[model samples]
Target: MVPEFFTQTNGRGDGEQTLAPDSSFSNLEEAEKALQELAQVFPQPHSFISGIGLDFATNEVSKAAVPPEAPLLNMEAKYRALVEQIPAVVFMAYLDQGIGEAYVSPQIETALGFSQSEWLEDPVRWYQQIHPDDKMRWSVEAAEMFLSGKPLRSSYRVMARDGRVLWFQCEAKMIRRADGSPWFIHGVGFDVTERKALEEAILEISAREQRRIAQDLHDGLGQHLTGIAFMSKVLEEKLSDKSLPEAEEAAKIVKMVNQAIENTRQLARGLHPVAAEPLGLFSALKKWASEVEGLFHIGCSFQCENPFPIHDVNLATHLYRIAQEAVNNAIRHGKSRNIVIGLSGKNGAGLLAIQDDGDGILKKQASQPGVGLSIMNYRADMVGGSLKVQANEGRGITVSCMFPIRSPE
Candidate 1:
């Protein structure tokens, strides 16, 4: 609040002139007249001007006080400090195009060699740095998240400023208004390059072991079983020639040995080489679906309305294994009676969807995925694809993998 007058003090005229203590006027006109009269006696340059701050609301002299926005400003500072000090790259941006609040942490410079200012300066810089191979799926998934208000959790490669390819496990959720409109997105991206490398090493070792066991079952155990069956049949014929009841016992031994051989072959097939089929993933999946139906006694079907060749062997392997795992999960965990596997490739991308007719995965279970689900997700990521497990509300679950059909020649 402004006071009526600011008095000049510590300067006197030719004699000792004393000023009145409470000579302030109520109106500015009276105060101006008194100030002009006083200025004539004591020249302005010789005196110091001073005034006491008055607080009329309190009816007392004004004292230092906190502004209304102080607490909120303090909380903002605290939260900003917390976010900046975290290990991962933290970001906040509006879910919509209109930028209400935008922030990128300092760790971005350490992680990707880009300063916080540089990242936030351009709105699309984050998307631009995504690995070229992963951009399309990211765009599609991001759009879905925006429209459906679902949280985004994914892992993909990003190109850093130093030309290094880094894998990141990114997770984000949308903040909404009271009316349920999206306000902003708070996200964190952790550098998982080392973790991904470790996971790949483990999967490779596991695959090698599986192939070794499959080879042994197919060649070593299967040949031994075949020999036993052949010898038992010879014994059964000899016993029959001798006109003895032992021929029936020998016939049972032959039957058991043959069954063992068939079981060994089935085990070997389940272990490996389905991915190495000549007709690529389509025929492999079709044959696998038939095998699943015959073996498990479940109704399984394969669909390929539009089919194309998958030239890349590793890609075929990944796709085949993904379908295999999805089907296995349906039979084992879901207890599904019917399963549908769909394959389609056109343009440069395709989808492999496996749907089951059983109890869908519970939401609680999905949050903590099992080992098979984890492996399936990893396989899809290795192939530059995204895997989505959608529950059909007590009907069943659908596991879909979206992947780019093109790979290096």
Candidate 2:
């Protein structure tokens, strides 16, 4: 008996398309005829009829099965939907081809007011959108990360399409081919503007409080100590004229009061170096070094090579504090016998570097920095500079801060 035959529409808009049973054709002529019809409908190379079947006895056929294209299309649609739904902007770039962004998630539009198409269309737009002051550092850091194939982690400001300055913390890693050659890069960016604003606010408040306390100590306590020392001197002179045994003791008391007054003045200076403004950074540094050497019995020297003037008092103060902190760390932690503080300026930039000839920072301590190092870094950032603390080649640690100097206008 001949097998049953049935035809099913393949759901394509084309009316002529049909499915046939998975059975042998009745004859070569019938098989040829079926193939010719399929070719006319789905004209391409390498077409196959899987379910179509025929019996030679009766020319009967069975039902056909659906094609593999349906499942693949569904998967692709789902993947795109998932990418678009993510909150953060997911990006992939072809590093080998001039760092072109191959894909940017849909969230970019909502985050930065720029469509994915707009970002992908311009390869240089990303670099161009960086804030002018940050462009050089950002480019250098990015280039280093790309060259070293290291994970890129950076926090920077980007100007969005609508002229909004947004801060983003981005992290990306190099993607490599099977043979270990770099293929591209992929990363995610998160908005950090609000967090940065909060941090800046806190830093400002702290700075204001420190200035107030320093002023109070200098104006209030320092004046009172000076008056006490003067009164004690006058009392010592009166006793000496009387030729009393208490005269010697009074003289000693006068000396002790003078010492206390000097100590109070030193404490006030420690709180905030008021001379930093009038004396300039160079003189303040020299005085500070002298004080450190006298107090700690360590060989501390300040050298300035072509010391350009720093008119901005706040900038000078921050730089002085960073140097002070570094010196203190070298003395207290490193037990340094000799420390060198150098200040130099060249081509609209200033550098303050401190090197200690003592026991170098331990590997563990370097990896896990303490509060002192953190404060130093924060101060460096406030002065528009970067702080680098590294162990010296032979011994000890070196702390360097390089900052920009605005030319007089």
Candidate 3:
């Protein structure tokens, strides 16, 4: 020991140590004597050794000054908890360059038939499960939106882990870093297959009702009117007598009956005409052109290749009514000298074009209400079709409609 002393309030010598001439305590007796004297002087919490020197110091150890942090909950546990509570599938991933590792909720098993682990390590495994025919196009669109730094909302088809196809609506947002770089994205999706199916079912039911009504008008009411006409003719023949004044009255009644029959027949044709079939769409179009031209004395022309089949009764009825409305509008409002009707079909689609060389629709636009246009649009919508009304190049109005050939059923 070199020196030992206690610095207390009084500053008195509370301890003392002996320094050997050789600076070493090799003998057990000398070490024991020095240790016994050091013990009486050294303070509590302080230590002394026989062989150690005063210059020999222990290295300082430092502990971190940071406060303790709370333990983090496992991501899988947190994810499962969230998914069980929400109706949608919640997903998290790093998607800046492309989709990185991610976690899909366990709900994925029920919604998409994919296990949670299958989608975690490979985020794009979701895309691989998408319907093959739609994947390429859907991916292109999604990637385009992502690169443009826009959020994505889309509906796509996915093949479930159970080998079933399902539809989903995905809504996602990107997370940007402090420097405006994309870091990741979070998304939620829900199954929309049931909703879509319900909508389709409602449409089919509506179409079925429309067809039934059309048939009733064609078969039931039409036959009764025909019977009335025949009976009226028989009564006229049995009452043939120049001497009888009631014979002239009976003749008048028969004439009236014939007119009523003709009118009823026209009404039946308007309702659902059998002629619509034999002539096909173009034939019906020609018949319509002739009747309207004869009625209004406005020259009408019909042309176009039979680009579509006229087998669908509902479609034929829709096209016929659309044409009927167009012609009536042209005669009453269009005030055009010539009207042209064109019908064509190709590639599983049908087209109906009507153009009139009239005063155009400028006058109607300013003064008359556009109820006709609205009605046309509504009728087109009823059949899952589109209607376009525009001014002709020269001086007329053109109304065009394109309808899908397949029935909703």
- Give me the candidate number with maximum lDDT: 1
Kindly list the per-residue Cα lDDT of model 3 for residues 213-274, writing each as its tens digit.
76675577767767776776666667764355666777787777667666755765655543
lDDT values for all models: 0.80, 0.76, 0.66
lDDT of 3 at 27: 85
In every candidate, how many clashes are there? Answer: 0, 9, 3
What are the TM-scores, per candidate, against the unseen true structure? 0.73, 0.68, 0.49
Better of 1 and 2 by TM-score: 1
Candidate 2 lDDT over 1-409, as tens digits, reads: 1122326556776865455554567797876666555545554413354334433234555333334574577687888789778777889888577534399998888888888888889888788887655565566557767788878666667889889988777888888899988898888888778877787677667766767777787788778878887888888888889987888888888788778777776776766674544347788899989989999999999998676777766678889999999999999999999999999876566778999988988888878999999998887665546677777888898999877665444
- Determine which window of 10 residues in candidate 3 has minimal summed lDDT: 53-62
Clashing pairs in 1: none
Q: Quick one: ranking by lDDT, best first?
A: 1, 2, 3
Residue pairs in collision within model 3: 307-345, 308-345, 336-358
**lDDT per residue as tens, model 1, 257-307:** 999998998888777745554356777788898989999999999999877
How big is the RMSD of model 1?
Answer: 13.8
Off by over 4 Å in 3: 1-222, 273-279, 363-369, 382-384, 407-409
The numbered model that scores best in TM-score is: 1
TM-score of candidate 3 relative to the true fold: 0.49
Candidate 1 has its poorest 10 consecutive residues by lDDT at 45-54
